[model samples]
Target: MDIQQQLINAGQYLKANQLAWGTSGNLSARLDDHHALITASGTYMANLKEDDFVTFNLQTGTYEGTRKASKETPFHTGIYRVRQDAKAILHSSPFYTTLFACSSETIISELFIETMYYLEDIAYVDYYHPGTQELGDAIAEKANEANIIMMKNHGVVVFDDSISEALMRIETLEMACRMILKAKECGIKLNLIPQEVVTSFLEDSKYKPRKKKGENFQR
Candidate 1:
């Protein structure tokens, strides 16, 4: 599929899964080393059209076409600039994930197999005003260390070599957050998988192969 259609499909899928709502999020795919296609400002992810996206210059922080790029363009470009493996990025405020982002709670990635893989190396960026260069710079500083970055009091940003993998990571994050909140609410003590076990699974398990940079894990 074309990049535009891929992003549209991702948007619709996110809407169907309740990972995104209304015009509160943005999605982008790297078009090349120097340019990206990002959802236009104020466009609803659930109903994105081809015209709803703008071609943004990653190096110049400029855009082509008529529509304005999403206000969060700085971070999108920043991630691409820092991480050459990043092909697609998804930024959204899902209920559970956003709740966790806004709270003082910490997430335990060793909770399960999926969490160990997807939530591994999550980075936190202290609260910065959305759309500001400071926020973008903060995210970029930690972009090389993680695939998922949580913006305190704002939302989460996930990126991977393919849009599908990016969506998978965000979905796993939301599920983990929901489980954590529910367990806390019920006063249930959750047993975490040991770090050694997690490391073993990541390194030796046959269930999933290690992900190499620039490999597309699109489903």
Candidate 2:
């Protein structure tokens, strides 16, 4: 499928999975080194049309389409500017992830195989009013350190080499967050996988062959 259709399908998937609702999230894909295809401002993720997207110039910070680009375009472009490997981004406030974002709790990625691979390098960005350059800058500073960035009192920004990978990351993060919260509520002490074991899994496991070099396991 085309990039536009991939994003449209992603939006519907996000909504159906409760990862996004109303017009609360934004999605984007790199069209080239200089431009991006991003959701238009105020468009519902679940009900997007082709025209609901704008072609944005990364260098000039201008856009063209039937509607204006998302107000959060700054950070979307900022991330693409810094991370050459990043081809897609998804920013949303899923219930459990947002609940964790609002708290001081730390996310433990050593809980399982998927968690170790996907949630291992989360970065937390302090709250900044949405759509501001300050907010964009804050997130960009940590973009290289992690694929999943938890924005305090706001939401998360996840990016990867493809839209599908980015979606998988956010879904994994939300699940990890839910597990942590549920464990705490039940007064259960979760067993963390040992650091040595985690390292071995990343290096020697069969799954290692499937991972792109320097992808997903970044510190």
Candidate 3:
């Protein structure tokens, strides 16, 4: 794939979807096992140009080109270090997803097949100052078993084998959060899928890509 165009397209999608507002998010893609193409710090995700990204050595922590890398570069590299399956990483602060992230909710219940399949394990990390080594360490540790991570009082971070898979997981979690809020507003009790059904889905090899060992918690 043309990685530069791919990163540009991902940025545009995040902007168009309002996943990153007020220059609050960042995106990156693996250029090779050793380096990544990342958005520059404070650049608007919606309006990006080829020069807006920088190539950074994930191993040495040095960057090439005149543009500076995003402050969250450490976390991006950290995730790539551990996850051989991760080809792309997106960090965005979406409205509904952040709501659950800041709340007491540790997990969104299994209410849909897509949520169960694409976002099977959602990990929550305690709030740390963004762009700091502390936060990067926390994210790297939690991401060991999570494709989607809820940053406490912050946003969500997702890394997947492909950008589409990562973005889809983000969308799935956002929709699930919206559904939970709507149900509460209506005073309607939720009808979650049974544990047996969820377990069956998890154990099935066909859907094994989504399943990760974790617990379920309601908002």
TM-score on alpha carbons, each prediction: 0.94, 0.95, 0.91
**Candidate 3 or 2, higher lDDT:** 2
Give residue 104's lDDT in candidate 2 (0 to 100).
94
lDDT of 3: 0.83
Off by over 4 Å in 2: 208-219
Say which prediction, candidate 1 or candidate 3, comes out ahead on lDDT. 1
Give the TM-score comparing model 1 with the true structure, all chains together. 0.94
Write model 1 residue lDDT over 1-219, tens digit each, in one string.
999999999999999999999998999999998999999999998999989999999999999999999999999989999888899999999999999899989988999888998887788999999899999999888787788999998889999999999999999999999999999999999999988998898889875775543222221
Error of 3 at 134 (Å): 0.4
Which of 2 and 3 is the better model by TM-score?
A: 2
What's the ranking of the predictions by TM-score, best on top? 2, 1, 3
